[model samples]
Target: MPDTYNITLEISRYDPESHLSWVQTYQVEAGGILRFVDVFRKINDEQDPTLAWASSCEHAQCGSCGIMVNGKPLLACELLVREAVDQFNTHTFRIKPITIAPVLRDLVVDLEKAYDRVHAAKPYLMKPAPAPPEGDEYRISPETLETYVEATQCINCFCCATACISSHHHFLGPNAMMSNIVRLMDPRETEKKERMDLLYGESGVYRCHTARACSFVCPKEIDISHFLALGKEGKF
Candidate 1:
């Protein structure tokens, strides 16, 4: 038979209108296999309808449901109950919104705020000058594409931003930095010096102290610090 576990949750709550932030506790009974999302679902369904959080694709692929579980940034959908217990080393889980983000309600944060720097960096491909001289000239070697492929997997979850120590400053954080690197690695991008200037600018890659907290909390297991280090060396 599947096992059932009793868990205690201490969640942070904020009221936008009243400017109130507080912590509340709840006792829940859940299956041992259930994820943190499931626990939150139970809380919303039965315990408190007013509680709020964000969740989609409940498998870590969407990168939503990012929150601080016992002071660690993580995807609520991906972290199992047993794993959370072991990771936190406590029976009661203390949950809150990730750092460096404005809390929209309770667990849900202002995703737009997290995306601001990325928007400023121009994350998408710039249209080639002169329209690329027809389509055939735009292709890249398979080996070249392979180099930056991993960087493209960033889901824009903002977990890295939460884990970053320098986020208190104007630093752009991990996802935005990776976006800059991806464009740098792309063979067709022509403004190499311009992109590098942005990457190395104030609140840029130089601000990262290589704490690797961003890499450690990333649900995707991306080597974000490695990319920044390579960027510093101008290795591309």
Candidate 2:
């Protein structure tokens, strides 16, 4: 095996100065063990210092380093360079900021709008069960919790939203709904009716057309289509 190889990245660049956007390509020398995020860092450090993107906790737990590579939205940190080349059968891959939002610069997208939907949906519990007295604690049986465990795994990366067909429009998007679903799944939550109202409203659950693209790109393997169905059926 060669010690190093070059990979080409076709990145979409937007210039705020002139209000122009274009695709620019860059080549990075990569080793076998590096990840896609590492390639971006190498580009920033060695090739173009002006390049911009967002990332935190590069461990794939923060969900901050989301980008579309080869027309698929997924976490950059979780995808390795070697795997991408092997799976797609090419060392050259096209990358751009996920759609359904405004681009700030290069790979950075404005997430506040999507976050607004999450906040509006009341992502947290309105009526959380109070802690038990003294040494006791509110508890849930494992069996009941198992029903919605996968839904609770959303990292809020907005990958699902980018993949959602209805997201670029008025729809609230899947990950945002997943946030609400997480709270609704809790047996201790008291406000099911209110949650249901928001989820079923216009631009709510029904907006999902069941394309299942969000579930396919989810790094957590969340059953997003099932959640959309459950929400539609008032089963949440």
Candidate 3:
């Protein structure tokens, strides 16, 4: 059975120059089975056609629909409105724009800078020369694969970045570090030492304060702290 209720969404809207902010409230008939993304779309179609947001895949895998729901970073496609009401025990879900970054419009945020930072990390595999003769695929044992599996789940949603206090002041955030860790832990990669050297540099993993905020807000449940710890201990 699905529970039906009225939800009040307080969304923050921004305009160019002087950091102008405004709030628009929407009354929605919602259920526990309906995601916030759907609710937002319904509200937009019915009440405010100018409401702006982002989404892709609508399955939490694309990581494009990240937003601040009741001051928490969440995937709009992943959370149901009624579940949110139950969790907070309130009919009104106050969604403010992300505080760490400048809001582009309604719910859409400017993640261009964050994406640039991610690219600067060069988070990718650098494989050695291919094997000769049979040229078989590189084999990774099951046990070894298990170790790096968690880090590989990142969808680059930047939710972790939104929650990270370190990134609030121009830090690189956790996603890149997580990416680095994945490659560092991969059995096929032979560039671990070189990658670690870059990661341990001033603007790299060393900037992390072990705040754990990144892991706390990650939709994928990636343990960013564990990877940071590994980097600190030179254990990767």
Which candidate number maximizes TM-score?
Answer: 2
Q: Compared with the true structure, what per-residue lDDT tens digits does model 3 show for residues 111-210?
A: 7755776777667777663554566777678998887788888888888888887876646778877787678777677877778776787667878889
lDDT of each: 0.84, 0.84, 0.79
Model 3, global lDDT: 0.79
lDDT over C-alpha atoms for residue 10 of model 1: 93
Cα displacement (angstroms), candidate 3, residue 194, comes to: 3.6
Clashes of each: 0, 0, 0
1 or 3, which is superior by TM-score? 1
Model 2 clash pairs are none
- Write down the TM-score of every candidate: 0.92, 0.94, 0.90
Give lDDT: candidate 3, residue 122.
69
TM-score, prediction 3:
0.90
